[model samples]
Target: MNLEILTPERKLYNGEVYGVQLPGVDGLFEVLEKHAPMVSALKAGKLKVLKDKSMSDTTSYAIQGGFVEVFHNKVTVLVEGAVPAEAGR
Candidate 1:
């Protein structure tokens, strides 16, 4: 799936990804290739990106809060703020 993570100041990430784990307001949820269309609220937490099906290649970010929309094999995340997990640490 194609994923884009955006903030008010900049675009954090934009690329193809195997899947993504989001910090939904209710808890955590994942979106994968060909996922059904939907939107959800997000909370402050880690957002993980699965670079491949193996799950070995991955990246993570700490997001403040946001909203996510999935449609047509694309995932768009609009957040208030975010930092790479490693950078945050």
Candidate 2:
């Protein structure tokens, strides 16, 4: 699926991804290829980017609240701000 992470100041990431783990207001949820269409509220937490199914090329960011929309094999994340997570392992 194609994913784009955007903030008011700039775009963080824009490319193809295997999936993404989002910090939903209720908890955490994941969006994958061919996933159903929907939108959700996000909270301050880590956004995990799965670069591939092997989970070998993963990246993470700390986001300060946002909203996510999924449609047509694309995921768009609009957040207040985001920074690369130094503690990603």
Candidate 3:
């Protein structure tokens, strides 16, 4: 699936991912390729994405709060703040 992480400052990630875990406002949910379409409100927590081609390696971001949209085989995350891999998991 296509995934993009966006922050108030900039777009953090834009690529294909095999899986994604979101910190939903109500709870956490996972998304995979061709999964059901949906939109979710987020909580202050982490967003983890395992690159589409690999499962062991992962990328995590500390997000203040955000929303995730899943559609057309793509996922877009809009957040107030986000921390990328270089910043630590």
Assess every candidate by TM-score.
Answer: 0.96, 0.97, 0.89
C-alpha lDDT values of all predictions: 0.96, 0.96, 0.87
- The prediction achieving the highest TM-score against the true structure is 2
| Candidate 2 per-residue C-alpha lDDT over 5-37 given as tens digits, one digit per residue, 9 for 90 to 100 | 999999999999999999999999999999999
Clashes of 3: 1
Tens-digit per-residue lDDT, 1-89, candidate 3: 89999888888999988989999998888988898889889999878998855667788988888799999889999999987645445
Q: Which ranges of candidate 1 are over 4 A from the true structure?
A: 87-89
| RMSD values, in order shown | 1.7, 0.9, 2.0
Clashing residue pairs, candidate 3?
Answer: 18-52
Q: lDDT score, residue 86, model 1?
A: 89
Best-matching candidate per lDDT: 2
The predicted structure with the larger lDDT, 1 or 2, is: 2
Q: Who is ahead in lDDT, 1 or 3?
A: 1
